[model samples]
Target: MPKSRKRKATVPAAPPPPRRPRPRMEYRARSDEAWYGARVVVQDGWLRVMFENSTEDADEWYNPGADFASLGDVEALRARFRRECPPLDHARCGDVRPGDKLCLACDIHGDVEELKYYDAVLETVERAAHGVEQCACRFTVRWTEGPRSGCLDKVGIEVVCCVPKSPIQDPVLSEFLDDLTKRFAEDQGTATAASQQADPTPMSEEELCGVLLSLKRAPNSSTGKP
Candidate 1:
């Protein structure tokens, strides 16, 4: 009988390496001038955060310190996203209508008291008397974001300001404005050069004195009496 072929010993397949836990967004932080969603994680025995909007190939770490006071719960973070402002002509409090969007300063209570601005929608507007200034106006607005989202609060013109629509929002208008600005600058430069060329050069002290002396010695041209 042919010897049974030695059965090749089969090695068991190794188990796949354990997967890393996905980062959980637990907090929001502000860096520079903008707010970003963030997650806290520990590395090398130190706490660090990864910003969701980071512009980097690898995760960038940030130290949450005094500067992180801007950091807050997700609700507060959401509030930082301000709504677009109204048109330039409608930027004044008096120009805002019941349906217009505006900004209101809100107090954030914590270890440190802070005033934060949030987007709000005007529900009602109480304008001051004809003679009174716009600052005297009052408004009822519903918070669009933040811990007070959807809550209505009465605010004064002092605490509320119109959010002006950015020129960049309209590409055509923005381009036109840019062209106008360039032309204005060029015209100003040309005007300055022309004025400089038209202006006469200053005379030296000696030349000025000599001219004055000659004028005094010469007969007065305007009056025959001289």
Candidate 2:
């Protein structure tokens, strides 16, 4: 009769080490003097965003559904742009250098500024409505209405509602820019007319500052995009 050997106690192997979380790809704004967000554009029929960095080298096209871990790595991002995006003709980018306090490319058509403002407002709303139920985000931009031709006229914005998602059109942002551009055109026209009659009185620095302050206080509608 074979004696049964004592069964050894089975030991469970330790579970594999938990995976390290992937770093979130968040690029900060260029500078306090500049817009509080990145400059985005639709170039060559592709959505692209000019990183808010102190260099033109970070400009690259973006995929709405693609992963952006590369954004955290500048060199890697540039390489990706070189491989994927259109050539840097400077025709669309203009002379916008990080050296100046202004972004020439963004300011060329004035759409970038509006987009930047929209981005800032969105951030504010998020911060204020954090952890609160029934909080809604509303960002709007004009579609198919701007100079410089092409699809640049059609504006789109990156919107965040409940969960994070890709860019979408927001009527608020759209109306804001639309009204702004319309007023600008009217102001320019008036300025021209006044100039022909007499030296147009430019708004004083204080008055200009006031106007700008009001813009910064753009009303936030208590609604979310559907």
Candidate 3:
């Protein structure tokens, strides 16, 4: 009888390690500065908040859902900046730029801004703020009727949140941009390789003539006739 070969013991491959969870972001507020969380407007129309003073009242109004007709025209809105707003370190940054919208929970002092002057490079990256006219993000509000609903009626609230430029920069967004750039490079490389493989290399003139001659009958070797 022939000897039988024994099979070697096989080890299973180990599974890949699990992915780590993404880091959570925490927005910081300056010692003197505080963010009034989203304030909701219950019934339609604006209600002037009654506080110790106009500055305190406007600060309360802008909290996460407070209603405002534009961020101004109210006495408290104008005075609050001078009264409630703390003096900043001017050495840190210049004036605000356009297109920058504020974040609710992030700090206003930690933000780093990207500035552009010339038109050529301006169109490449997105700008956060501009001049004194920064971007404002609006919150949708529906008017409701309370016991006093008949007093004012339906009016939408326009919320002006802080632009991150004056505060904290987002780390998650920076990472996403980096990932997008790498993906674009890989996709372009794949397309270039595919194009190269689709077209075959050309044959030499000598090769083409030899191939044609082989297919033709041997020039009448025995007969020596045309």
Candidate 4:
């Protein structure tokens, strides 16, 4: 018999290198003035970023590290933005009317001139000229708190921010409670009707009191006393 051909040992193929995790869509970077929203993209084997508020051309690419100092994810950036820049009360501003409560910025002069916000009630709103923008409308407000309390002054809409509306105005919760109350009353009425049908004669007050007293004096299992 012919000698068996020597078998060549086979080498296992190497596993592919682990892939890098893709970057999240939401990112923020700080410029000299404020935090700007940014998104990352991979182009020609290089990671690049673009800012939402960038004044530069849209096609311009920025280095992640060299361009931005403190880079943060979406949540962190939002928190920072909230802390640094309080949002304008657009809801209240939209439907502002007389007697509406508002918080407005006040310029206070002491050792240092400081801009502060104080609670106030709107007294009147003066719309801008028909040709002009509504944002130019002036509001007359009476201060309700702080050193300027009870004072009335005309201020631009920009100085005013919306007061948080009370949660009691939520119609969903009110409707739910109303439905629940009606259902509970109906159940109680049904139970009472069933009970009355079972025994048509009503119990006298004295008999009802006697029954209650007997129940009160009945055995107490835990204490072994009536």
**Model 4 regions more than 4 Å off:** 1-94, 110-113, 129-134, 167-226
Q: Candidate 2 lDDT, tens digit per residue, 90-145?
A: 12222222221111112233443232221111111111132222323322222111
For candidate 3, write residues 1-226 as lDDT tens digits: 1111111124645633423222122211122233221112212323222222113323232221333332232333322221121211222223322332222221123322311100000011122343343332222222121122113221111122223223223343333333444555676799789988997678899999999888675677778754
> In terms of TM-score, how similar is model 2 to the real structure?
0.18
Ranking according to TM-score, highest score first: 1, 4, 3, 2
Better of 1 and 4 by TM-score: 1
Clash number for candidate 3: 20
- RMSD over all Cα atoms, model 4: 24.9
Candidate 4: 10-residue stretch with minimal lDDT: 1-10
Cand. 1 TM to true fold: 0.35
**How do all models score by TM-score?**
0.35, 0.18, 0.22, 0.33
Q: Give the TM-score of candidate 3.
A: 0.22
What RMSD does each model have against the real structure?
Answer: 24.0, 29.7, 27.5, 24.9
Best by lDDT: 4
- What's model 2's lDDT at 69? 29
lDDT of 4 at 122: 90
Query: Which residue pairs of candidate 1 clash?
Result: 85-163
lDDT measured at residue 157 in model 3 versus the true structure, 0 to 100: 13
